[model samples]
Target: MTVTATLAGLDPTTLGDALRVAGSPGFDRWQDQIRRTGGCSDPIHLTGTTVTRDRDTGQVLHSYSTEAEPGGRLRVACGNRRASRCPSCAWTYAGDTYHLIRAGLTGDPAKGTPHTVRNHPRVFATLTAPSFGPVHNRPGRGHRPCRCGIHHPADAPELGTALDPAAYDYAGAVLWNNHAGHLWRYVTIYLPRELAKCAGITQRELRERLRISYGKVAEYQKRGAIHFHAVIRLDGPDGPDTAPPAWATRDLLTNALRTAAARAEVALPAVGDQPARVLRWGTQLDVQAIGAFGHGEDLTEQAVASYVAKYATKAAEATGTVDRRIGELSELDKLPDLPDHTRRLIRACRDLDALYPDRKLWQWAHMLGFRGHFSTKSRRYSTTLGALRQVRADYRAAQQRAALGLPDPDDHPEATTLTLAHWAYAGHGHTPGESWLAATIARDIQHNRDTAREHRAALDTAGEW
Candidate 1:
């Protein structure tokens, strides 16, 4: 079979190389490696050797070397959760995020959460950054002309652009992003205080009666500002498994959130000639009560989980900014593809770096001055991403042991083993032929997963599980 003829629309040069790779003797092994990665677009290459030994008997149990593998190196997924960087990894990340958020709300025995958590008071809250300057926006409620004298569409490129870039508070915009994490921290601290006050009890008494659990993700707005979407829940002192006091209701949680948000403020010290600035959340606060399971509402458990997970893998790219670190000032000039608004934000970050070196504005200029993790959760909210990844690793190890006819790790009461490994980073990414093949495999795998999910949903609708 002529592989080149089968693959239409590919350039002749790329087709020839792909055909040669397809006919190579190591093609099967190479394909297996790519499949193992779920067809990651940019996999990391490593040169290494690993030896497993029985610690008690001082016997070599297993030995492996990348030199023996195809291309004389091992390839591993980069595991970046950014969708633009690697879709394969991003999909996995979104799935894990969905599971983590869902487990907290709906409970999952496998994840060590109780089903009774569904009874906890929960709300979906959105905290936004205060305006640094007026920008074009589509006002909700009755279509009206924007301040720019034009009714901008939801997808308009000019929607978030400043009406007057020169007069806009660019420094304040960047600084707000830098301090967003601190603001959120203060909000969390004040939340319990407000709840206690509402209950006419002290902080210590409130803690003894109830606890606050939350999972939040930061998202970039089109104007290059960061906002947060969080699922906030009220649990008993011991956590989700225990029922909250009768006084804790969704209305109480909403009132407490509003009070905390209004009271939470971060004061920034004067930088250079700039005066001390006080930053707080925008007035457009949204706090909605999440309905119980099977209830029809926008704030249902599944809808909230899906919404948070959808943004977990996104970043400044959604706001016309690059999703990478900016190293030098001159680098920005070389890229004409960036929008003017994004360029101005990046320039502001760079210009302020000298004045506020401690903030590391230049280092995170690509992110528009935000350096915090996109997704974060309070301890005891649910299982963690690290724990989920460890579970996957353990499952894979068990599969490998079974394939090799070895005893299960749990079967041996007093057995112990030591693993000796040394690895060096060789490089990253793939050759042109490899890149095409890996992308195809990734698409197919994602398609299959989607199909399976749809089929399961259909079965669930028909009461088939």
Candidate 2:
């Protein structure tokens, strides 16, 4: 039997509903709504009315109602950063992340960052979790057989699985993730102190002479441990626009990071009869100097930005864990589909939740106990995600204004406009037919973007515009 026929046979009700929607007279309008959402897999349905009034004249300039929209509701992308949930939204999020990181490195005047930031002493650093146990891994240097006597491929599923699962410290692993943020906080605190020691100055003196600005993103390793990829910059006390002191070189920053990572430790409170465990960064710290936009042998600003952005959309799923919450202990038994390692981690999280009620381990079990933001930046690092999103909103508003032939809001400062909007959540998700069509549209958009990028790259290589 054909796939469609088989699917229809397996779920007739859903198939029939999808078919009916496809044949409906409003299908084109429905497709338009879906396209406006960038083909989000689960677009949020909102029923609302919006009235735009000129405050000066007390006249209704414009009004909109979802009553005329498809299904009497407006749909918007869920805006989930997880690609697994919504690829369309995830793509948008990754693009925003890339720009945010790139702006900090190369600078964008529009984003309030100066081009002089490119000359700041910057390094791309990777901070990792201390090993809880030995896991199957491909030893660096040359491809060698694992301790398990197996020569694992690059994509091997067994790569991160413990050689002896029974002996693995699952509790330690989960707790490490829970405390990772705290550990990073300690590192940040100690970093300046280390820098001062290196410069033969006091912490107060270091602060007066130089400042540290950083942007970091957390990534889950195959072993389900959380690690950090960061762009660390040493700027003058005034921030990125000002030049760093002569003593603030890339080597000094790298050494300070190494010392801080080594010294930074967080000791957990002793629970029950268990002794307090001290958490610190793993021995495998990699600090690489970041080069200027188009020079030097080290990592380029664009490469570092792209690399950090790539991890911003990911979670524990990269390590075989599920991308959702575990509501109950019975849920563990039903998750036979999960890998043995992942299942054990979930079980450990659930089990530990009772012992450490304050930790709320079960709440973040899906994340393997991590609760930190995927991407974070210091205040002076660069523009914010909110600022980037505002830029997009402003552009869209401008387009709408031009299309409607409305006077520029900025041009009329004396007149104010009041917007009243009320929206109620209706529902989400699409009919199977809608899903199929939306997916096709998303693919086409991505393809066009990729093609345009390729063309641009080709033109650049050929030294043409």
Candidate 3:
């Protein structure tokens, strides 16, 4: 497992490229930049200069430039949330999502949420799409054979593919995905009314006495359909900080959610030869009460947070499709060994795009016609991703300032510091050798994190004993 031995096995061109980077005088500095970006697969290249000066005295305090850096450029993380695009950035995104969801459930004082939120009536609900047609699947309970008369393995490639492609309603499935976000919006709108009805009160009175807060993430099923998993909480009118009304209970919330989901529907007008359709949630609905501690069937705060975070970094790639946008129908043919079911789904998107210009099906063909944000939250759902990122940015900036021996901006308020900066995009992506090196660094970082997490878990278990 030596670096030299690993390099020896690489192709000649890659070996030569790696050796060139290793031999460069600025190699260490370049490595540091890569480390800072967490080994982003496709980093953005920038050329910039920044000068900070005292506002009162007009005295220059600090200055930075890429003039002396490797390649006269700075490398920054692309910050794409899709794991298929960039795993390092996606890992960071997932971590933020975990904290955001956790704060709303268990509460994080530092993130401005009080611990009282954990006592609030909360439920984890999964909303699924109505089936368009029969597909090959593993039957629940009994080990039944598929419609084609064969017991499929867990990893079978044809698991989600239609038993008969001609019989599958590809257009209906794609249309449902395109309007999934709208359906969720309708559910939110109908939720409070349902809740009020259960309490024998009007929707207006419910709004005055209580508020509904939620955090949700969309996950793609193997059938290329979009489903939602949400953490819904009943909060006071003002939000999580205040106590909910006496009438607010887990059972009531659960019942309201079930009713709201059933009532929320989207209507689509006829397109071409397609008939007018009404889209609604599937019969399979799961609503479970969240417990402070996972006891028996109850899902714990930690487990729910982890589950939602897991899918925040995923897209339609789980359905055996490409990650990037598909420009033309002709391009689908050029794709390497594209699955037949996936190809049809993509083709459906293209076909409908012309008739439904507003839906932008072609633009989201890669996503199987689903274009909504993967992760979303109500305004009162604890902290936000932007705020979490800002905290990290501020901390890193403070560290850099300390390293440069610059006075803290907070320390000298009498003389305010003015920062001026300008940056232009250069090129991006790594050389073949650099890609290998970056992958190695990413793996190392992940391994270290995994080891630390396992160690902490072991200590916790030992303490319990």
Q: What TM-score does each of the candidates earn? A: 0.95, 0.94, 0.97
Candidate 1 lDDT, tens digit per residue, 357-405?
Answer: 8989989999999989999998988999998999989999999878866
lDDT value, candidate 3, whole model: 0.91
Which residue runs of candidate 2 sit more than 4 Å off their true CA positions? 1-15, 296-298
Flag clash pairs in model 2: none
- Top candidate when judged by lDDT against the true structure: 3
Candidate 3 regions exceeding 4 Å error are 294-298
Q: For candidate 3, lDDT tens digit of each residue in 181-268?
A: 9999999999999999999999889989999999999999898999999999999999988989988999999999999999999988
**Model 1 spans > 4 angstroms off:** 1-7, 11-13, 53-61, 412-418
Comparison by TM-score, 2 against 3, better one: 3
Candidate 3, poorest ten consecutive residues by summed lDDT: 1-10
Report lDDT (CA) for all predictions.
0.88, 0.86, 0.91
